[model samples]
Target: MQKALVSIAVAASLGLGATAAQAAILDDVKAKGYVQCGVTGGVAGFSAPDSSNVWTGIEVDYCRALAAAIFNDADAVRFTSLTSQERFTALSAGEVDVLSRTTTWTMSRDTQLGISFVGTMFYDGQGFMVREEDGIESALDLSGAAICIESGTTTELNAADYFATNGMEFNTVVFVDQDEVVKAYEDGRCDVYTTDSSALASERSKFADPDAHIILPEIISKEPLGPSVRSGDTQWFNIARWTYFALLEAEELGVSSANVDEQLGSDNPAIKRLLGVEGEFGAPLGLDNAWAYQIIKLVGNYAETYERNVGPDTPIGLERGLNALWSDGGIQYAPPIR
Candidate 1:
């Protein structure tokens, strides 16, 4: 099943005029007329197709913000749904410009995958989900229980290490990808399902009875998820990295889509610099002076994106938690744009 996704991703890249592996990704993207983004096949609240088949989620918005920065059109981008196994290979092979899916930033992936993580978009942790009737109040109660997990992800290793460290024995019903894993869990093939706490919330929303499952409170691992790009393209990397920072900077500076126009006329130097009214911050990244401005005006700030996609008001219902700004007692912080 996942093998077919490889050909699809490669064909999409080739159709977009993939030329000269060493060629700068930005140049190639410009030539192609749109940014090619790789995303998970379907992960609600992260990157999943809506009823009309249009992709929607926080990660999708990140790509939209990037497109706004580069082309001044937030819709100037396309997506390819990828399985976890093919995401890295697809990126390394030039099959996609950026992997904006829910990929965790880990040591081995950072140094060994020939890819660079832009920044932590969402700080999450490993957790378990079970039927509310199971009466399992904690992950510690899952000893010897069969857990459904997706293969080719940090989830498996994290589940293994967590169980072993806790002196608990377990069995994993591994599947090739997330959709299959969810299906097996729903089919009653596994007694428990485990993954990032955010994902647990997202996936559970799709269940027949959303209130039938409960996510355990024991967070087992630190999962800093973010977008990533192929290594060796400094200019492209800078563009991708700064796009994330722009969202955070906008949130911190009180700039949003609704007020970006008004703030543009304000005299605050940081606001001016962020909106391209008083600084050339976009020049170094080969983007226009209004790059961040376009992002804020089109995609809104980080808080806006989070709230609209997966906040307490959305069906996924995730709190700001560690995704809140550093000034608000969270770890999210961006380097000043000077």
Candidate 2:
């Protein structure tokens, strides 16, 4: 069924438009009074369920941000936990409204999977992790080592590419889920673990002895992770994409949750336009003018979500790095709300 959907979508892109193309998912979500969001099942600081089965993470905040934009309520959202292999399938099958997991945005996935990426929520790179006791200080020493990785992710290709480029031979232990990959590495089934660098930090933070594992300094491939929605619905696409951009713009303009009410009386044109006090930007997308305002009011800004979930203070302990505001020596730029 997934393959058929992909084929039909590819055909449509090639001028073989299908008559059964889907209507706006945005309408369906509104009619349901909530947004169903797909999230990673176990990646710490990105998406994970607590003991009560309640989800909270940076990506979870993204889903909440969307809910706030639409419903003016952050809690009016549902989370569907998914593995790397199942995330895209669940999204394309309409099992979820939006995929806010740590899914990388790539050309093949965007074009061949009958899905559209909203925007990059996190900038990451592939790296390796190994036990500190292994006497291995760098990825270069893992030539003959067995590496554990999750299948159905860009990490697979990246691992292969990096190994081949360096003329190194290594055994690959692939798993259907990240949990198994982490477990396999923990159980000594593989000599090394590889994934997005931040993920390596996240996974290691969960270990019984985090200090025993060291992430190698080599960052191999770019992984721009973000949310995605099924294609054939331009309105839904716009809503998801702009929801992310709104958060970035909010951070860039210093319009945070605390000062948003105060900024309403200010004279800054960018702040006024972003909060919908001066423009009709939301109307064209079937949203009210206060869409962005509601998002920040309920879910806060991008930096707030990041700091709370995976910042240097969190157990995952990730710095903003490349995810900082564009004006602050980072690449996290967004289109103006105007």
After aligning candidate 1 to the native by TM-score, how far in Å is the CA of 284 from where it should be? 1.2
Over 1-338, each residue of candidate 1 has an lDDT whose tens digit, in order, gives 79988887887676533333434888799888899999988888899998899989999999999999999999999999898899999998989999998899998898899999999989999999998888899888899999999988899999999899999997999998898899998888998999889999999988989898999889988999999999877789889999999999999999999999999899899999999999788887878999999999999999999999999999899999899999999999999988
Model-by-model lDDT, in order? 0.92, 0.90
lDDT for 76 in candidate 1 is: 93
* Cα lDDT of model 2 by residue, 237-333, tens digit: 8889999999999999888899899988779999999999998988877788899999999888899999999999999999999999889999998
The number of the candidate with the highest lDDT is: 1
- Write down the TM-score of every candidate: 0.93, 0.93
**Residue 288 displacement (Å), model 2:** 1.5
